[model samples]
Target chain A: MTDTVHSDSAPPNGALPGTGDENVTGDEKMWTARVRRAAMRTLPPDKLLPDRQPSYVASWIYVFGVLTIAALVVIIASGVVLTWKGPSWWHVSKVGLFFNSIHLWSVELFFFFMVIHLWGKFFMAAWRGRRRATWVTGVVCFVVSIGAAFTGYISQQNFDSQWIATQAKDGLNSVGIGAFFNVLNFGQMLLWHVLLLPAVVIAFVGLHILLVRRRGVVHPFPARARPARHRITGAATVPDEALPSSEIETVLHKDPEPVR
Target chain B: MIDVVSASIVNLTHPGHYLHWGFIQLSLANSIVILAMLAVFVLALVLPFRSGRRSRR
Candidate 1:
């Protein structure tokens, strides 16, 4: 009796909405589908409010998003400490040196998580649901992150900085931005990396998350039995060759049986 | 009295070894403060998510 009740709460075909199946016969399946549809309808896409909580592309990989945010928080805190002591504090105090080291490590971790997060989003094809703005904002944030890292490296008062600055200047010159943003100026780089770039990065990240919460997760690419036209945006087909394997395996409505 | 005054001025001008020692001490101090902070950060990230499911119930 409970089995039937549970099944009823499930969607038709026992598949979740956006999981690709369109038809079902079991009463439980129908009930579940109705519930799911109801939940989706409640979320209005017009203002960036999603009706459902975002699910993971997979459970194992979900924590990395939190980890990335955590790392950023660390970077900011360490940066504050280092800044509090002042740039020359490193030369004058033992504690200052340690803070600098921590700051360095935090930045490294931040990049590690940032790269993984970007890749995860792309593979999920999360740019759907009129989320092109989110996608573009993320890409811009990525570019800014690179800038922040570059300026940070230049600010490090070491031989590596000296060599990188001279080498990097040429590349920057070719683009014409170098003429204005001199990489060699320690004072300028320090201020930009510590203050200006962080503000930009944080703002963009906040906006990206707002959109994610609004649209919910991108539906998994359709399964073989389902036509791509059934998706939210049927304007273009995700070519058989174009679909990423991980997404295909995870998202398709087919039973968990081996694809082989 | 003249000699003592001259010696004091010289010592003030060249507080030689003490200055280098101060820089090293500052670096060590910075490291300790950062390590403690990093530990707290790691804990915060790990604990909240682990406990979130249980707390939601």
Candidate 2:
């Protein structure tokens, strides 16, 4: 009975006809298709490119994250120019020197803003609302960025670079990583600075941002003031004397809940 | 003393080596870069968000 049913329903091209319930249960079953579907569900277009944010998001503290991203853009653009011109060109030509300066300053700005953002998030307890992954990814990005910056310093091809490389080797050697890292090798440091570490940092930052968007911003602390009570005469009043000291204390100490 | 103070000011304005200790050197150009970075960081920190209104709970 089964063989007869299969033979009768099979199409000439051997492709199954779409079920009417295709919308309810998608037809595609390949791994990539499944992943794509899951990704779309997890990060819908509207959520990925949100038109609005919670009112609590309108804070100056949130601006440093964006500023750090802006500095990263500058750093990458200047880095590309520096890489295209080669190290000697930057050391000799005025145009190269200017671009090099921009690269240096942009990195400085990136780290500075990143540190500020890190501190702000720490103080805000940004890991709240199951956002531990986001916080961890951010910290990993910071660590990777330090590697990128260190490699950049070693690649500078100047007295400063020379001194830093010589000083850093001892620390690396003490940790037994120097055998592989070889800070004295300019070529290796240059590749790590320009290509490998930046890629890792970018990947981590992308994950961190995705998690942030997924979790939404954590809410600000709730106001401590209590609502006024209505008296028998219909006058609103604070009956502070009547309230229990412990209850009042609990209300004052209550922390804000995570924003939906 | 006046000459030394004036020279320091000139060094700050001009891009040249201001401090040298053994092989390590700190130049006015490097100092300016550091200052610019600090300025950007501070601005991002203190700058008002959207129409200068503070966010309220």
Which candidate leads in DockQ?
A: 2
Q: Evaluate residue B21 in candidate 2 and report its C-alpha lDDT on the 0 to 100 scale.
A: 81
Cα lDDT tens digits, model 1, A64-126, are 666777888888898888777776896457688778878888887776666666666777686
The TM-scores of all predictions, comma-separated, are 0.55, 0.69
All-Cα superposition RMSD per candidate: 17.0, 9.4
Candidate 2: residue B26 Cα off by (Å):
13
A224 in model 1: Cα distance from truth in Å?
Answer: 1.9
For every model in order, the fraction of real contacts preserved is 0.00, 0.28
Q: What docking tier does model 1 reach? A: incorrect
Model 2, C-alpha of B6: deviation from truth (Å): 16
TM-score of chain A of 1: 0.64
In CAPRI terms, model 2 is classed as: incorrect
Model 1 C-alpha lDDT per residue in residues B1-57, reported as the tens digit of each score? 644765776554543332136455444435655565455445533453421221121
